[model samples]
Target: MADPPDLAVVSQPADLTNAWLTAVLGAAVHGFSYERIGTGQVSDCYRIAVRYAPGSAGPASVILKVASADPTSRQTGAAMGLYDSEVRFYRELVPHLGSGPAPGCYHAAIDAGSGAFDLVLEDAAPAVAGDEIRGATVEQARRAVTELGRLHTLTAGRPSLIEAGWLERGSLLNAELLTQLYTLFLARYREYLSGPQRSVCDSLVTAFDHYLALMSAEQRGLVHGDYRLDNMLFGARESARSLTVVDWQGVMVGPALTDLAYFLGGALPADLRRAHYDELLLTYHAALGPEPARTPEQIREAVRRQSFMGVIMSIAASVVVERTDRGDELFLTILSRHCDHILDTGALPLLITGG
Candidate 1:
């Protein structure tokens, strides 16, 4: 293979020339075509069909990710260091994750000052992205949680990674901001919210500061801050990976169970999640192993305490991102399911009482 390309990051799909592809891919690329992929508001994704020189080695197709075209969203991504964190994840953290859950990063580059970034990644074709509105099947949910457990297990308590600058950065979503956002969420979405959903939001907003403090004090590790269905791609029958996680822009060092709770909160209907809750938890806990020695009850409580994360995500993300018809539906679906999870787990009372 040729030496790593010294090419600069391309800011948009129009800049993906054959010469640039050949250099970054370390192969002779005669031409390529790309079509947009995913519904991400903060960034754009494209599936590139590479036409390489005969016998030259390279993936036939790869996923190319770049900063969002929307100036507002691009600014938001840069301001929050989302682009930098994702670049660092592939450049710094994926090696440790092994072949666990994330996609293989072929190339990653970011210009922090400009927030211009690009990532070429393995195309997990045939593996369909999960649907937050439709929710996941029992089998899909099981696979997702199991992989999440492995992710947490790999990074949990690793002293070297625990304090890394990229992972340890503080979230901008503090209590005051969340409370303000929740108020805005209510103004826009209140009519759509169920009575229970409204109650859940009220409780969370009431205790936002206390909740943030409590969660911050808990055991922390690498967490996919937005670990919900939309960010996941479930595998096909013959696929190598059962799940391939994407969108590491929100990755951070935080309470690991928050990922679990965030995922479970929206990946299934309330009834389905309630019915299979223990089995799913056991699957994750078992995959996590016994190093930390958390009992079933402890895990349950931790998940319950962390359940409000999805609520926060739904409200905050819905308001901030470029809104669309699908964005509204997706966020509403997430909010409804997560409110149900909170009610089922009694997360509101737990937050109020500081458990």
Candidate 2:
């Protein structure tokens, strides 16, 4: 395969062309057009339909992800290293783990100097995106946890993965940044939070390092840093692939329980989660293999400690992203559910220090 064209500066729909698509996608594209899709905050996603010249040998359509045009969002993408990490993930890691929930990428490229990039991935349509506000059903939750186990187990304790500079965890949750972001979060969303909600946020923010340290002591693996219902696309009832996990920007190597807790925390409503918590944990553990690294009690504690993940994301993400009506509603949904989980699980007590 020839080196693909440099799309280091694709800022609009018109920048894409048949030649560029053909080179990267390894097929002849007679022509193509694109339409913006999704409510993505940090990047713009397009559904591109290709007009194949009869003998073209590539997919009919693919999803294209690029850095956002919005100034703040683009700057955030550049600063946070999201675009580079995602492009690297598709280029390096995805190939090793074949035929899974993640989408198939025909091409993944990043222009490191400009912090611009592109991803042409299998368009899993007729497969709808999951809604964070609506919450997930038990079956959907089951598939999500099972797939997550597969993701974690595939690279668990792999020295190469743990040592990769690009895959190493970033300072997104550093104490200083989290404290600053938490302050901004409280100020911006204070009107929407109840007393208990405010209290939990305050406790978590004050003890951020302590909580993070507790999680760091556990066994580690691949973590979908922002794992949740919203990042997934569900296939049709009869399709072989049940779910496709998207958004690799937040990829990191960390305790698997982080993803597990974050997913269950934001995904399920407080009541439904409470009822199925044990079953869901066991499901994930079973899929992780019989001799799991963490015991049931350890998993329970980690889940309890990490349940505040949604609250942290709700606070941090809302402040950074270009907010809209749906964004507000989605973040609020995560906040409400996560806050309730913390209170219900008595997680706040874990963050408190003795006098």
Candidate 3:
């Protein structure tokens, strides 16, 4: 890969545990002390084991997502206002978050201006059975789309979240967004992607400015910036269609279809995904009944127009879900076919070098 920026601190299990207890629980010396149980690149998810609290007889536990405080995170690349937007998002929409199957936030905080953030969250309402089940499911897809619709409904025009002490600016989309996305794609992909696939990528990158401009003019609303499968959990009991949208750090105010397209088109098998594509649009439209300038027809149109995003993502991004040796191999396999499909379909602007 590449050397990381200086600002970012490498995630160490011990360091994260200390930070969590000291920053979140130590002051009160609460019965619940956390142990770093889950470690992923995104956040250090901890199992907060509570032996006993004042009145409680036994124990309680919850999941905690510790926001990264690495200096490199800022220097190398990351969206600005993302952490703030997430804290703001949970605070604003908690009321609508019915117990159905979502993990409720017990408490969420962002340090004054430093952007160091933490969340004391209720455990996943219903634990997902396995990693395979963890992948996108039709049920989860429906629930996720509906939730995004509901969120957009709540924070539509309000420019500031008065009660939450935010400008209601939604989330900021900045240079880092494009830079990181393109970098992540161009680096690993250049070696394996066919000339035609690279052509499509280059073509899209060239047209990015116009694309953003067009999307900017749409009736914007809250977006789960990275609404992919892995960031979510199936509902506590109902089904995969019923799910709790987990990661919120990348929340933003933008075209709503961005999330829907990302999931259905990005994750599900092509045929199974296309099957529900239109139906999902109608479902989401029904969710957002009457927002100003937000019409169902237009939203549906946006879905179709921007739907090609999946194609761009398919070729540029390695299909591997995470950091592993197998991940790279898997990504190459998926991308190579994607490259073939694009070229055979006449989708590229120029043949990328060394197809």
| Full-model lDDT for every candidate | 0.85, 0.82, 0.52
Best by lDDT: 1
- lDDT (10s digit) by residue, model 2, range 192-234: 9889888888888888888777767766677778888888888
Error of 1 at 100 (Å): 1.3
lDDT of 3: 0.52
Better of 1 and 2 by lDDT: 1
262-310 in candidate 1: lDDT tens per residue? 8888899888999999999888888887774577788898898888888
lDDT of 1 at 206: 78
Off by over 4 Å in 3: 1-40, 57-59, 69-79, 92-102, 112-115, 129-135, 156-184, 194-196, 238-241, 289-297, 308-355
Off by over 4 Å in 1: 1-5, 290-292
Whose TM-score is greatest here? 1
* Candidate 2 residue runs with Cα over 4 Å from true position: 1-9, 157-159, 238-240, 353-355
